[model samples]
Target: MRVFTVLGPSQAGKSTLVRAMAGLDKEAGQKLEAAGVVTLQPFSFMGEDWGAIEVAGGAENLAQAGPALAASDAAVVCVPADAEAAVLSAPYLRKVEEAGLPVFLFINRMDQTRDRVADVLAGLQTYCAHHLVLRQVPMREGGQVVGAVDLISERAWSYQDGKPSALVELPDGVRPREVEARGELLEALADFDDQLMEELIEDQEILVKEIYDVATRTLQHSQLIPVFLGAAEHCNGVMRLMKSLRHEAPPVEQALARLSPGGRVVAVGCMGELVKHLGKSVLLRAMNADCSSGTEMAGQAIGGLTMVAKGGNGSLAMGDLGRVVKSDHLRLGQVYLKDGARALPDWAQPRPATYRRLVTPVHQRDEARLSTALERMGEIDPAMEVTQDEATGHALLNLQGPQHLRRVIQTLKAEFGVEVTEDMVPPALRETITKPVEIHHRHRKQSGGAGQFADVVIAIKPLPRGSGVTFDDCVKGGAVPRNYIPSVEAGAREALMQGTNGHPVVDVAITLKDGKHHSVDSSDYAFRMAGKAAVREALGEAGLVLLQPIVKVAIHVPSVFSGNLVPMVSGMKGQILGFEAEQDAAGWDLFETLLPMAAQDELCSALASATRGTAWFQSGFDHYEEARRGDFGAK
Candidate 1:
């Protein structure tokens, strides 16, 4: 059996196409409850069994498609018939190109669009690295697509509901268009085949087999992408698409060679993990060798193997995806070889997290359970991350966007039974003094027999940015005992934890100018209290300012949407640094700017809305700058 992955934007009919190919339901698009999850379906076409791995189509879920693509024989990219929808395919196309896999573009919902195939191809060409060739030209009647003329075979077929297309005579009105598209397809094939080029130049008749051979070779080499038109909902043109895949898609051995350079036996690709009722099951794709019960993988024996469509499989053959149960040693994105296990070289890393929320269990006693559930969720979806906020000591759930975070929260409640509440992550704010001030304090506590007596005078001064708190002993003639000086410094450092603004004080220096200590009553506790009280009095005298964290962000989007970025950034009170055209990515631009950490979530949401979810940004901590106290409600 051969395996191929179907990917596209959400609601582009990817799941519907997969279901149609499997002969399950032609109307599956209407009942798409599991649209954000990866599913595997099996089907038989022309006596050859095949598997289709349908990946989540949302832009936020693109990270899940990497492992699926890496482990498959080829990729079938399903895109809507609308021309503007082509931009949404950019990221998926890049992934398939990087994996060096043969890719096919299926123009779904052809019956619903009036746009010509030429215009759609032109829009997609801007993003694809490979030359796209139209394999079939749509045959429309009354402005509705009813059939397609195959460019390779020059045969015409009329679509039928819930069945294979019926053969039809070539209509005269469609002949000219068919000839033009066939010519273009031949020309594209000629670029990679010298013989075909000569035949085309000499105007000689080309055999169907000759065209197929050229198309197959060029496609496997990633030189050209063949486009097919179809309305998967009506089961129209699906069989034709399947026939093309069966003949033109690369074999399992060829896919293995592309994944691993040399021909090595016993290679298994771990696509992902599925948490089942029995236990955790590792989704495995056999790239080279057949895997069965007791097959040694990643230094662990596979207790059992189960197929996605068929249960209790005896053995998983090459190019087939199955689940391995009762095994805890396998990991996602890892390729198991005879020598050792290693990560898939072309596996995509998860995008940078932009949205964050502080998550806590509803019940305090379930904190441990929540932590365990989050750890498992991280393994299931690498795009979601769990981290600790240094300033507040809260567990922050970092995700690609709002939708990604919501899915995680839902999973925590439904799957793990760990109900939780979420809140916005607090900004890590800092406080600093504006000027220097001198203060004196005496911590005298006369309680019963032993009295606590200590005195100290300290001067506090503001320091430059990024210069953390500093302590200096400027006492003359040891007026304050040397042994007791360390305690006073410790107490002063602790006092800076909460300043007048209720934030940690930074960029300040304190000096021990003078102090009096009794030989019998000058204990560390007495001096510590004196130091704490002195610093409190000094901070009150000196004014405090709040500093907000600033981040340097790099935003990438199609150049067509570049104009919308400036205003969006300005609305967030950000400063634009500069921008330039992205290298190697045509029609795309990269912009750099400085933005406040508090507005990162808003920026992400705004970009998604403005760019139709085609824009993404990465940010890092730059520095801390003084901010308006009113912004944070600081007193």
Candidate 2:
């Protein structure tokens, strides 16, 4: 039994489709009588059949049902003929693509369109490029979508009011145009079957088994995305889609190809050996195995999982076919790094670097627990480094990007109960003298314990950019005792590491040309104190400038929306880099530019809302530059 996600825009007739496929009445059972929420209306077929699974609708309901929706195995993307509905439907499709989930798209309400099935098929050719593959040619009756001819099985099912009617031979309307469409889908599937291609080129009818096997492999590799016809409102063409899924959905063995090159189909590994994360309750994670080559799903046992809850996402143990699930939503999969992918035994892959100046913890008191739990996260993804930042107390966890962050955070809360809080860290600033200065300092003290005295004359000069700080022992005849020289160096280094603006100081050379030390009373401690005194005096007289961080951001927005976003970024102190036109990848213009880091916060949500969540972007830290001199905020 394969799990498939049913994704589409809100009210694209997904609920109605589920009812029709489940053999339930749309008007009466549309709400799924047993289940209060109609979103995840699981329709289980024959008690013994490795049946087809249908789950949930998209939109307000979909977002709230995230945990349940992600648990699906494959997806059925529904696109209504309505323009606004289709435009909003892209987000759901993009998510399925991002998850690498195998999906079959249903072009709903095709009977409402002006053109016939052939024109729609031709236009869909360039719609998603390689991401889409049409599997069934839409069957038309009197200008209405009455049924579909399965390109793979060559089986046609004519429907009336949502039910499959008597089976018929391939119809005349699709004969000429489908000769090419069906051949194309089969040809793409042929790489998985040489004999299938041979029979096709020779003009010989290919057997159903050959076509099914090839199509399964193609769907598993995401090379062919089947498009079916449906009109849930009218109860049209739903049952035919259901029957096709029973024979079409790829077996577990084929889908594993995405995880690795063909490896041996081994026996399923034993459970309980894995380290299950303990939250309020224990949560187990398991991996999928190649069970298609005759492994009986009935042989698997659900031992020791005695206390079953009302509902939970994990193993789907129905007699023999046992599958591991991570979330209630079937679109998501278990996150894993290929073995031996990173250097550190704990590190699974090279973690991505972090350019954010400050990282705020997402929840309170989460620093310690999150650190312990995420140590393995860095191992699986070498690009991450999880720890605490001493300066700001931020749980400094570096990651690849926003997607990686979302996944980790979800797993942490749902699996570990680590409520995190974020405290954004402000970027470090630099203060360098705009002009050179010479300074002198003297200290004298007399007390009952002992008399103490020290004096120094130092010149601080700004070096060419990149010429680091340097100090010379120019005192004549031990003007400053050898024992005290290190102390002076220590004091100067500390001052440089912490500048007047509470940032690191750079690009300066200090010369200790003259200094006197009391032979009896002078110590390294006194000299160290004097060096600290000298730097403070020198920097005060030397004019200084503050440097700020710069970052590069690529924004995707419609051309009409760019007119608004461009000025928004500019107002945030960004420099417009350039722009280019694109198609589906970026609905409109791709805006690329460099901007200050301080302006980036909340930009993601802003962009998403601006484009109704259609836009995407890549932002990176570039370098540091002097901030524009003026009032910090409103004058």
Candidate 3:
């Protein structure tokens, strides 16, 4: 079976086309939401089984498609013919290209569009890395597309609304355009095949099988995209699209060859609610052989096996998607072989979450339930991360975007019965000494049986930012006992946890210069108290300074907004390093700067609004700097 995923921008008619391909009603299923993955019934293509999965076009949902693209044997990118051909599916196209999967473009809703096919194809070429060769050209009637001509077979078809196209002779009006498109398709395929190039150069006739072979190889290597046209609402041109998939898409063995060899079974998706008796449902993609119930997959018994398509059941052959149960060692996007597990490359890893929201139970009494609910949610949506902020002790849900976060929140409330509200994350700060200070302190207790007594002298100095807390013992003449000295250092370190500024102390060094300990009266406890007292005295004398955490941030936006960055970062007390053209993304600039953590919330929200949701930024902890008097509501 061949697994093909449909990816496109929102409302591109992706789901409808997928349903038509599977012989289902176009309007039968619910509209797709963020992270929605729908599997259609298995259908035969050239007498071989094939399954199709549709991925919704929401920006946040595209992150989830990366894993599916990596898992599938091929992909179909959908674009609406009626809308401006802005290549809104660029992100998905890039991901599919990176995965080295065979991909084809479906120009859907053609019956509603009046745009010239040449103009639409030109716009798509800007976003696609490789050439998009037109495999089929639209046939127009009464100034609208009524059918399409196949470039490969030199065949034309006239549409019968709500039914398969009826084959017809090449139209006299479209003959010249068909010949030109066929030549272009052959030229693109020839670039990848030396023999084909020689034949084309020699003006020799080429067999359809030879052209198809070259096209299949070119597509499998991601060197070209074959374009198909259709209005899935009327099921027009759907059969030809499936035929192209059947002939051009590579087999499962060849597709899985790019992945590590050890994995006989690989699972692309992680969420399924089947096989309750086996504890959890596990979806597995076969790479080498067929599987059945009670089959031991990767040393775990498959208590049950179910097919992905509707009414499809029984043993799963190579390249089929099915649900397995009773597997204890299974994980998301993992490859399991009889010997060991195979890891996916870095690109296959889920994208880092760009949006963060602090969450807490509305009633504060369902914290535990919230934790469990988040864990289950994470299990279901691997792209969405749920973690606790160490500094603020707040529950933070890091997701791809606001839409993805909203879906997770909705699931938490509706499925888990846990109501939560977004909360403000507190600013995290550090404390350090501004100047060095020397202090002497005595810890004497005369109200006890042994009457404790100890005297300690120490010097405190500030280190460079990020140096953290350091301790050195420079005692002389046994002034401080070796065994008692450890306790003294421990007490001093403990005191630094909450400095005079009520924050963790950092970048300070303490030296034990001299101290006196009575062998009979003074013990570890007394010396510890003396050390703590000495540190406190030094802190007061030296005066503590509040330091704010600075982050190294890189903001990527369309070049049009490059001028807005300086003022934007400066407004948040940020220091700009520089900016340059972003190499990975064309027509975009990358601005590098240092920003305080307190300003991150405003920056994230503002950037999206300013760039019309085209710009984004990522940050990492850089160092700590002295906070300005008025920064971050500081006193």
Global Cα lDDT for candidate 1: 0.82
Q: Worst ten-residue run, lDDT, model 3?
A: 25-34
lDDT of 3 by residue, 1-635 (tens): 67888888778898788778877333232222223453444565555666676777755676666556666788899888843544365556656766777888999998999898888888777556678899999899899898899898888998878899999988899999999999989988888899999999999999988888888888878888889999998999888888888777888877567675544444444234222233445566777777777665556656667775433458777787777665555555556665456555566656667577899888778988899777755654667777798866768888777777777777777667788888656667998998999988889988757989889998999999889888989998899988888878987887788887688888999999898988789998998888888898888888788999888989866666778777888988899999997665544688899998888878877776676554667788899999998876666
- lDDT for each residue of candidate 2 in 496-609, tens digit (9 for 90 to 100): 776667767777888777789887667676777788788778887886666666778887555546666776677777899988865544235788989777666555546656
Q: Which residues of candidate 3, in runs, are more than 4 Å off?
A: 24-41, 44-47, 82-87, 140-143, 166-176, 266-279, 309-313, 326-328, 358-373, 392-396, 554-591, 602-618
User: Clash totals for all models, in order?
Assistant: 0, 44, 0
What is the TM-score (0 to 1) of candidate 2? 0.66
Those runs of model 2 whose alpha carbons end farther than 4 Å from true positions after fitting are: 5-43, 47-102, 108-131, 137-213, 231-238, 255-257, 260-391, 394-428, 451-453, 461-477, 496-513, 554-571, 576-592, 609-611, 630-635
**Candidate with better lDDT, 1 vs 3:** 1
User: lDDT per residue, candidate 1, 372-395, as tens digits?
Assistant: 887766655666779987866668
Highest TM-score scorer: 1
Ranking by lDDT: 1, 3, 2
Best-performing candidate as measured by lDDT: 1
Candidate 3: the clashing residue pairs are none
Candidate 1: misplaced stretches above 4 Å? 24-36, 262-276, 337-341, 441-457, 474-486, 513-528
In model 2, the worst 10-residue window by lDDT is 340-349
